[model samples]
Structure formats: structure tokens, C-alpha cells
Target: MIRVVAVLALLRLAAITVAALPVQWVALRLGSSLADRLPVWWHRRALATLGVRVTPRGTPSSERPLLITANHASWLDISVIGSLGPVSFVAKSEVATWPVFGLLAKLQRCVFVDRTRRSATGRTAGELGDRLAAGDPMVLFPEGTSSPGDGVLPFRSALLGAARAAILDSGHTRVVVQPMAVVYTRIGGMPIGRADRHRVAWYGDMDLIGHLWGVCIAGGLDVEVVWGEPQIFEATTDRKALAATLETSVRDQLRAVLRP
Candidate 1:
């Protein structure tokens, strides 16, 4: 039965992924260089098990301390980007409390920001700066929350201010603010439209179990990613203006991907 197979495949996928947690934790503690990409290999297999096809475009910068900013559609964003290269995410603090995913995020060494607590912002900003200075490429979803796959939401400027701080406080003008777009292109061999996006996008109030069930049961989903031009956050660049520019670039890519 379709239900049985989907459930079995999902359970198997989770089991394998969860089983690798301790190894990742040890790697993080041991200060191994392989720590950067070990989790990505795990994610590739897990995503392959789910029958999702991810196609990426352009190239992420190889330069040290790159800061990638992108639109958030679903929890799948993590696997999609993780499949690309060696990178960690800057996520909200609450992600650490989520059941399985929170654990995985920690294994991946994701930077957590408590957006509601003003004091936490400075602390998180310091961590981000340190990571950048240490030469780890970090990805951030500037929408501050995930949205339906219809289009990109206007990016918030608060978090982006951290990019500036990284350059000024750390004296590392080497950060690349690369903009990217993740578009869910198809489901069941047909192009997906706004009407069907909710199946992939996990907006607030949507039950995670039911959403994951819907995605796993669906046939042959397709995802396309566009890596836009990388821009530098210089001393003169205003954070709000930078966010608007990147948001436009991402929205444009989404429009192109949605074209018939």
C-alpha cells in the first residue's frame, strides 16, 4: 500500500539519520575538519530516500566566511541546501527544542538566534562573527519565518545587520552575502502552482506530521535552486537596502522558476 511504503521509507530514513547523531557530535567536539561536510552526506541519503529530486544552479562562493541569504519555503530547505556543500544554518533558537530536527540542527552546528530576546541578538551576532572569522560559510533565511512557495516575503533587516558587524568587529571584509532561491517546481510529474504549494510549504498552524506525510506520499517532487550574484556588505551599505536588493533578486528567480 502507498501509505505503508511511505511510512516505512520515512521511518527507515529517520532511523539512519538519527543513528548518525553521535558520530557528528563527536566530530564537532574533536575539532575535525570533516565536521563541515559529514552531515551533508547524511542529508543526501535521507533526501534520496524521500524520492525528492534537487537540482541546483550557479555556484556558491569558495571564499572563506561566506554568508548566504535565501527564501524559506519549507523544512525541506535544510536538506536542499545541505545537499549543496559545506555550510551551516543560522536558525531561530526554538529550532533546538524541536523533537528530531532540533537534534539534527545541533549536529550540523547551526547557529541559533533567539529573535524575541534583544539580549540574545548581541550574543548570536558575536557567534556569527566568530564563525565567519573562523572561515565557516553560514546560511540564513532572512524572511525571519518560512512562507508559502508562492513567492519570497520581504526580508527583515534586523538580522542582516549582523553581516555588517562581522566585517567591522572582526576586521574580516571577506564575507560574501550570496542570495539564493529555492523553488518547488513539480509534484507527481506535473508543475505545481500556488494552489498546491501548501503541500510543500510548512507555514504556521500546519501540522508537521500531516505535512510530512503529504510530501512523502506524493510522487517524484522536484526542487530547483538559484544561487544569485554575491554581494559584499560594505561599511557604506545600509542593511535595509541590502535586504530589499537581495529580496528582489530572489523573487525574480522564483518567478522564472514558476514560469510555464
Candidate 2:
């Protein structure tokens, strides 16, 4: 029965993706607003098909040149966050080479960064800044990598340079850097304990195909997305300090959900 459910869920997701691909392509060519919105619609529908319920707490700021910093736990974070609004992501370059997901990420206008190369950092920051200047709210997982869904890793300060870059490119005196947290709290209608969180998390050397199949078969996932206070990021703002502050905010929010 579980295998049947997983197979059906995968089919539904594939159908949706196939249907949306051409529309997204045309929207991109025409520079239509649909290009920005269709991903959100697709993500919401995808989550529904997977029996994943998202509970968003607090509101995302409406500020322009906005950069949101969030903790990463699973590959599901993309769809989960994209479902909330028209937002792009800052992802590792390897994601751009992924089979189907890479295409989806490109359609969503994600900025891909080659993290292995130190010199690529500035270039990626500029690209992220350009997107932010174009009025796209960009989501960055400053944790640099996904965690085990039990705790947030220390956020790296390198890519926070995008905030400074946004100010320079957009002619904005300051950029709004908002902290966000994504926590998987329940699975199969029961509170998911710390030990069981690995089922939802996709970190380490976990096989993507296996993890995705497990999620589809298990279903009934409940996720909490908490948006923290928005901070004004100026040109002179210390990147290390700002990254630490945002990290603390996300860590606190995650703890509140997982512990309380």
C-alpha cells in the first residue's frame, strides 16, 4: 500500500512538472509576471500532493533588495520555502547539474555558486546582488550546507557579502536581511522526535532517490516556517557579525519549535 502511494505521488509530481515546464519557459521569454509566480503555485501543489502541510509564522518583509537567510535541513526546503512566495534561492553549483531538479531551480532563477572555488565567491555575490536589485527576494542558506534536521550548523559569513553588493548595485542605502527557520515537526500525524528527524533530513551522504521515496511513502509531514525580525544591512555592516546574528535567530526559532 505504501509503495502504491509513493508511486502514485511520484507520477503526480512528474505530471505537474511536465505541464509547468513549457509555461515557465514561455513566461521567461516574455518576461511575464507568471515566471515569478508559477514556481510558487507549483511548489504549493507539489507539497499538497505529498501530504506536506506548511505552517508559516510571521510575515516575510515587503522590502526591496531583500535577502533572507535560513537554516537548511532537507532537499524539501526548496519547495517548502518557494510555496510561501515568489522567491529565488542561492544554491551550490552542483545543484545546477542535478537531473530534473536542476531544471526546476533554473526556472526559478536560482543563483548557483561554486563553493569549492574561493574566487567564485565574489562573482556569485554579484549575481545574487543583481537578482536582489531586480526586486527578487533571494533566500540564502548561510549554514552553507544542509543539516540533520536536529540542529543548525554554524552559518558561514562569506556569502553574506551579497548584502553589501545589493547596496552597491541597487543604489539602496541598506538591504533588508531577514532570518528564517524551517523545522519539520511532525510526520504521519505524530510528533517527530529528534531521532526520527533523519527521515525528513537529507544531509551527509544520504541517497536523494531513497530519501524522496521514503517521504512520498510516509507522507503526512508538518513543517513550521518562522520569519524573524528584519535587520537593516548597510555597506559598513560587519558581515561576520550579521551572519552570527541571523544564525542565532534561526537557531532560536528552530529550538522553540523542536523543543517546545
TM-scores, all candidates, are 0.96, 0.98
> By summed lDDT, which 10 consecutive residues of candidate 1 come out lowest?
166-175
Candidate 2, residues 151-210: lDDT per residue as tens digits?
889999888875577558768777889999999999999999877878899998999999
Give a tens-digit lDDT track for model 1, residues 162-243: 6568657887654678999999999878888778888888988898878989988887689999999998887778889989
Q: Which candidate number has the best TM-score?
A: 2
How much does candidate 2 score in TM-score? 0.98
Error of 2 at 84 (Å): 0.4
Which prediction has the highest lDDT against the true structure? Answer: 2
lDDT against the true structure, per candidate, is 0.86, 0.91
User: How many collisions per candidate?
Assistant: 0, 0
Off by over 4 Å in 2: none
Candidate 2 clashing pairs? Answer: none
Candidates' RMSD to native: 1.3, 1.0
